[model samples]
Target: MALITRGFGGRRRDDPNLPPGQYRTDDFPVLSAGPTPRISLDDWELAVVTESGERSTWSWAEFTALPADEPTVDIHCVTHWSKFGTRWRGVSLDTLLADVETAAEYVVAHSYGGYTTNIPLEDLLDGQAWVAYEFDGEPLVPAHGGPARLLVPHLYFWKSAKWLRALELRLDDEPGFWETAGYHNYGDPWREQRYQAD
Candidate 1:
């Protein structure tokens, strides 16, 4: 039996800003591989581990103290939904990796509740990504990767890991949770890379 979802297979709006096969939606959908993690602000920390085993740790206060950037970007998901002009504020990856010494070319974002996702190092640099704590001028809620989440707008929303915890720099790319489960190793919505075959 084929299941039909409302507004999923309905009429298509002519929006050139949206990627191919994606429908623009005002609603921010909540999708997760597991239950939402309830991490306290006081207990939150972000770790950046270099390939050489060097580690830089930042408490919640220290992270929030860093310079932040406000970005209005379009986010696309693997499920064919695109949200445009979303406002976010957070510390850029350049700011985070500026002092960290590394020769790695890739990063695997580790998140709370054991969710993981891999992204190229270059994709995270040059103001391409951020560890976002606020959405739409308000503090993010747990259902939306609360304390902080990796915001990589260029790629599929899955690449923007939720509930970001630690980021491990790697010399070579390693497939993370979704990648290992038949999802594309690198999810680029523009390319429609959703499954392993993509």
Candidate 2:
């Protein structure tokens, strides 16, 4: 649901296409908490670890072999920028978590460079999220979360952790790097849930 905030003003407004306090931008802005980490495809792997300690992993080749989907979604950042019609090719989170057994309701998406973001498990299942390896028809560049990144377009972009490596299932909802630092625990863009207070 798109929201309307009467007094909010900043970026270019596209009321029908953006969340409450966002403006449309054609350029994909790069925002990272730290230096981008360089990772080689040969060493790239995605692991799904359950709360019971069981683990499942997929190498680069194995991961790419799974079914892929091309999704064109509009992404909203907490910083107030919204990019529409962004195209991506990726393996759905459903495919990644299919064979794994878990009753956990939360997950912590871990990245190669120590970045982590907590997300509700429900938000990742079905067709809600992806482990995207391509952006705009090309292999994702490091500055934009190369190799692969979690694509949860429904939420704030930060929940879509870049350089995604592992998903750790949790019985409890734990605050990740940004969540602990003041970002909302569940970043629903339409709600303008950028910070915890929202």
Candidate 3:
């Protein structure tokens, strides 16, 4: 069954991609737990380190110069809003992790704002995730994770960390901000896994 959300200013979309307990919204909402940070391209970099100690870093220009992919994916937020057909262009995690070998089963995504989120490595590889810079064919604005953000569309929006800075592969699971704060560890919206109590 799908929700017919026709009340909030006529947001009547009924897409199957929407998760339960969520309403379809044509508008994008800004949901950040802390004040948004202002990061400059010159000061930004992405560092990827494997559990076995393989280290790689990419400057802003180098990151953008990698092969890019444009993916239009439906985004589901744990806060109960589902936005469909959202578009983004970025370098896939596959491209970044291509030469790196990791036996780690999980990953921790760190943000410039000191926020962190943990995810399974399997969820990020094989074209499942990206470091997106453009949204809707435009340079992503800072407020919405401009310069670059981790785009993990399969999970709740928060897992797609804004202002992404580093990725550390872990052999064991390490809980992140929300995960430690009672949000479900693995936020699969389809299962209505919003809170840990669920």
lDDT top scorer: 2
The digit string of per-residue lDDT tens for model 1 on 103-160 reads 9999999999999999999999999999999999999889999889999999989999
Residue range with the least summed lDDT across 10 consecutive positions in model 3? 8-17
What local distance difference test score does each model get? 0.93, 0.94, 0.91
- For each candidate, give its TM-score against the true structure: 0.93, 0.93, 0.92
Q: Give one digit per residue, the lDDT tens place, for model 3 in 1-198.
A: 988665753443355666778888899999888989888899889999999888899999899889999999999998898898999999999999998888899999999889999999999989999999999999999889888999999999989999999999999999899999999999999888888988
Error of 2 at 153 (Å): 0.2
Clashing pairs in 3: none
Candidate 1: lDDT of 184? 95
Candidate order (TM-score): 2, 1, 3
lDDT of 2 by residue, 150-183 (tens): 9999999999999999999999999999999999
Model 2 residue 10 lDDT? 31
List candidate 3 stretches off by more than 4 Å. Answer: 1-14
Q: Listing every candidate in turn, what is its Cα RMSD in Å to the true structure after a full C-alpha superposition? A: 3.9, 4.9, 4.0
Model 1 — TM-score against the truth? 0.93
**How far in Å is the alpha carbon of 8 misplaced in model 2?**
12
lDDT winner between 2 and 3, please give it: 2
